[model samples]
Target: MTGLFADDSEQIDRRTSRWIRDAVGERLQQCLRPESRLPTHLEQLMSELKKRDPEDDSH
Candidate 1:
């Protein structure tokens, strides 16, 4: 009975892990789509920063 429970538990854990991985992969695909763009405010801020210190390649 103990060994049976262990096997069942492992199977449940594997299914749960696979489900999480699939969900995260779907979310990542949505976030990384080519149509994704930075917000306008952030883009402006980055442009200003680059103009302020164009030589700052330390980042």
Candidate 2:
């Protein structure tokens, strides 16, 4: 109870916390590419899922 959780969490959360949340939101929009016409800027996002495991799919 006094390792990674007790230490580093706060520092990491403050520094790169936005990255995780942004990735989650961006990934969600990527999943909808097949059903909707995505904007040009989203081209990479639409294809991002290919990098993840097909069996581990999560929305």
* lDDT digits (tens) for residues 1-59 of candidate 2: 46766765457542254456458767867887667866777657645643442432454
Error of 2 at 49 (Å): 23
Clashing pairs in 1: none
Candidate 2 at residue 15, lDDT?
26
Cα distance off (Å), candidate 1, residue 40: 28
* Minimal lDDT window, size 10, model 2: 49-58
Tens digits of per-residue lDDT for model 1, 1-59:
35656655445454465466458647756887678766788568656654655444555
- Tell me the TM-score of each prediction against the true structure: 0.36, 0.33
By TM-score, who's the top model here?
1
C-alpha lDDT values of all predictions: 0.60, 0.58
Q: How accurate is candidate 2 locally (lDDT)?
A: 0.58
lDDT of 1 at 6: 66
